[model samples]
Structures are given as C-alpha cells and as structure tokens.
Target: MTSWLKAAAFGVGGIAVAGLATLVAFQERLVYVPVLPGLPRAYPVTPSRFEIDYEDVWLRSSDGVRLHAWFLKHSPPVAGPTILFFQENAGNIGHRLDFVRMMMQRLHCNVFMLSYRGYGASDGHPSQPGITIDAQAALDHLSERGDVDTSRIVVFGRSLGGAVGSVLAFNNPDKVSALILENTFTSILDMTGVMLPFLRFFIGGSASNGPKILNFLVRSPWSTVDVVGKIKQPILFLSGLQDELVPPLHMRLLYEKAAEKNTKCLFVGFPDGMHMDTWYSGGDRYWRTVQLFLEQNVPRMIDGKLSSKDEDEDDGRDCLQRL
Candidate 1:
C-alpha cells in the first residue's frame, strides 16, 4: 500500500480505538465499580482515632433495594441541626466515624451517615437511578422522626456524594434545611477532563454528527450541572485549593452558576489542603467552620416547615439577624 493510504488507515484505526475506549469506560458494569477492593496493602488508608458512637439503620429504596447506613443520633438531645450525610465514594459508614464523632460532639447536631447500594451491606447495585432511589429511601426514613424535627434537617455530601446531594436538593428542596458540598465538580464532563484529559474537546469538535448520537456515545452518569442551578436552598461549598482529584476550579465554576446569591451561598477554600483530608487536616478551623455553618443556616428548631423552599417566608438562617 502507498504511504498516503497507510496513514489514512492508521488515522481511522486511532479514531476507532478512541471511540471504543469511550464506550467501554462509560458502559462498563457500575456494580463492579463499587466493588473495587481496598487499596493496596503498601498504601492503605491510615485513619486516626476519634470517638464515634454508632447505630445500624436499614432503608429500602422505592424500588425495594434494601440499603444500609449508620444513624448516629445525638446523645440526650442537644437539639441543633439534624444532618443527613452522604459519604465519600468508599466502603461504609464505619470509615467516617472520626469525622462523625467530631460533628456529633462538636457540631452539636445529630448525624446520619449512610452508604449507597453495594458499598456496605446494602442490597442491589450502584447506578445513577439506583443511588437516587437509595437517597430517597433514607430521606423518607428521616421524615418519620417523632421527636426529630424535619424542618431543621441538613443534607451534606462529599465527592460522588455531592452528586447525590445535588439530586436531593434539586428534587426536594423542601426536605433539606441546607445543602453542603465538599470537593465537588461542575459536571461529569468536567470530571472526565480531569480524569481522562482533553477528551471534552472531541465531544464537541464535530457536532454535525448530532446530539442524540453524541449523547448515546458519551460516557459518565455523573452530571451535576443541571441540578446545580436547580437547588434553591441555602448552600455552602468547601473546596481544597490544591486538590488534583476534583479540582477547586470546577467547584468555583459551579458556584458561579447558582440561581440566587441570597440563598446563604458561599464558597470556602483551604489553600493548603488536598482532596479528602481538607476537613481533618485543617483541624480546629475546619470543625469550627462546619459547626458555625450549621448553626448559622440550619438554626435551632423554630417549629414550622423548617426545610422547605417557601419564597415569601424566611427561616432563622435567612432572617436571623436581618429580621
């Protein structure tokens, strides 16, 4: 074959390779994705000790997938904010005890730290719809509190949990007291740029191929962009400046798109911290910030529709000092 023909063939093969890579990475079993074993023994997670008390909570999704979680209700009722925490992408609620202990004791709020489908003993698999269903189930469980105030409930998430957080905030802003996202990204496209690098360019480079084909061929179920603007509740975003995993710039870009500036929304950054360790590594300042945020926005129980998105009426967080 002539050199021109050979070059053309090679170019076609490369496109084929790239296309195949995109399809497989996106469509692969998300079930196995959650099942990745603990990190290599040589580089295991070194967790420090903290006093975290525990309790087992079971929730069945609307679809009947039984999920597991830890309900660390505050001891003897200090009565601050009740937080429904979505864990980072990982094993189970057990790993988050140190942080939970600090929040429960320090933040003075009851914390329910829960896992998605397959992470812990939860039945079924992890996927976009599945996790959303799982979250709704847990939210329903929280709604059933007799002594617990539903209006003062807070929703917090980190990393993949942020996507979970966004979904909850978007669909049922009324159920959430306030929304807190840590180390989250703008969208799955942004995440892919961070994870795969430069492929976002090609996704739009030749759009004459049409949006439907582009949509079908594209990978990633983690799109938070649409949900980002939909969330109308008070929001606080915590990002690490030096984070390479999710990148602070992504979160910053997201903060810009939020609908209202008056929703008690603010983006806080740690100039010296990394991805996951921002809170723990920042020490006293971190817990103080977390506690103050809950207190400032969530407020003590006022006894009337605490978490809903009522435009005319305002809560303690909104009307705290102003009113």
Candidate 2:
C-alpha cells in the first residue's frame, strides 16, 4: 500500500510540473487571439453600406510592418475633432462598423479605426509593443492629413485598446488633446488576480505556489494603472457596472489614478451595461457625455491659436457630479 501511494504521488507531481511548463511556454497565445490574415468574409460591414465616405489607409509602423486602417470622414467635412479609435483585442476594424457609424453620425467626428498587426489584413504578429507602434503610426497618419483637425484629436479606446491608447496619449501629450477609455482594466496582472483568485496562493498564503509561479511568466504586462498617473490630458472613463470580464472596480481605479494629475477627468457609469455594451446601453446619454468632453477639451483654433476658454473656466467635477 505504501509503495502504491508513493507512485501515485510521483505521478501527480510530474503532471503539475508539465502543466506549469506548458503554461509558461505559450502564455502569449492565451493573451492575444489574433484573427490572422486572409479569412474569407472577415469583415461583414463597410462604411459604404452606411453611405459614409471612407478611405482604406495603409500605414507602416516604425518597425516597418505594414498596418491596415480605415479613415472614415464625417459627413459635411466640418472642422470637428478626429477620433483615433483603438478597438478591443478581438475582431478586426471591420467588425466594429455599428459603433463606428454611431460615433460618426452622433458625435460628428472623423473616425480612424486601426487593425492591430496580425489582426485583419495587417502584417506581422500582435504584441503589446507591436500594437503600440501601430497606434503611433495611425496617429502620425491622421496628423499629416490636411482634412483632419490635428489640434483636436481624441484618443478613444475600449478594453485592451484602452491600454494602448493610454500609453500613446502619455507618450505624446502634445498631440493628444483628450482621452476616452471604456471597460478597460487597471493592469493585466491585476486582472489575472481577479480572473484566477486561486493565484493569490503563489504570492503568499496556503493556496499553492501555482499562481505565484505563473505570474512571473506573463510577458505582456500592460500595466495601465502605472501610466495613468503620468497623463495630464483631459480624460473620460466610461464603465459598465455589470462588466463581467474587466469588472467595474478596474474602471474606478483608473478614474481615481487619472484624477490625481488630470483635474479634467470624467467618469460615467452605466448600470445596465456589460463590457462591450456601454455605448448602446447608455443610449443618447453616452453621445451627450462624449460631446460635452469634446466641446470642453478639443481646442478651437481661430488662427493657429486656441480660442476656447470653457475648459479653463470650469473643472470637470460638475460634469461627473451630474452623471
């Protein structure tokens, strides 16, 4: 009996070690789910379907990887703000047409939707650093366009894109006038804890060292919380209280961190919304809040000089209080 028990113990230990090894080896696969290039019927909708004028733009990342994007111009060509939109980790830029159309028609802002490297028809693989480069390239493309009002650029991102946008805004404070993040996490590490509470055992306690061991293996530690405090640009944090993936606490923490330096921070919570449903759930209120933020932050240039003094006169606390 004792010999049999010893053999079983050895087998269990071997399996655990094998499992840990496999996890560490391919952890990137678990984080990034790139849809790959050349999938038939990948994009179900296009701007032309809605009668929106758009240009299929091809950009090159700083690392020389060619990226795909869509520059959807607002109708009537008003000198309004241009939104550099970074989408969630899943799906290509073509998958988000409904939201894009809503933003263009409601906010009346030019939208530039970028497909991260490896997703959609873009070249190369997707990584935290790689996508960040893609974002910078998209921003550069928009900035050079004569039709785009470069001074009134807004960086809007949702979910994983939020981290990308925040980092870009922090790096280019002079270029990004305002930022909007929806259903974003504080950090991938923090989110890991939330997703796998059992991992806490690795840090300390009696749960087992599995989580602690795996934590060190995460390569893409996109810690948005660390960078939020450094951003001085006006920010709007939209949270879905019922978000199952990221949770509302993450958004609140991000809002608190940004508020430390950015007195222009605004947070709007949607009671009936899930992770991706905040925009639709909030309805007209969502667009109204976004419009208010744009009106206050996106500078109005009369003759190469900022003409709007509304942002200077009022802090964003009143706006948050009303929400």
Task: Quantify all predictions' global Cα lDDT against the true fold.
Answer: 0.69, 0.82
Error of 2 at 174 (Å): 0.6
Q: How far is candidate 1 from the true structure (C-alpha RMSD, Å)?
A: 6.1
Tens digit of per-residue lDDT, candidate 2, span 148-267: 888889999999999999999999998899999999988776665565454444422121234465556667767888888899999999999999898798889899988988788888
Q: Can you tell me which runs of candidate 2 are displaced by over 4 Å?
A: 1-19, 36-41, 201-214, 303-320
Candidate 2: C-alpha lDDT: 0.82
RMSD of each candidate relative to the true structure = 6.1, 4.2
**If scored against the real structure, what TM-score would every candidate get?**
0.80, 0.86
lDDT, candidate 2, at 253: 87
Supply candidate 1's per-residue lDDT for 113.
Answer: 68
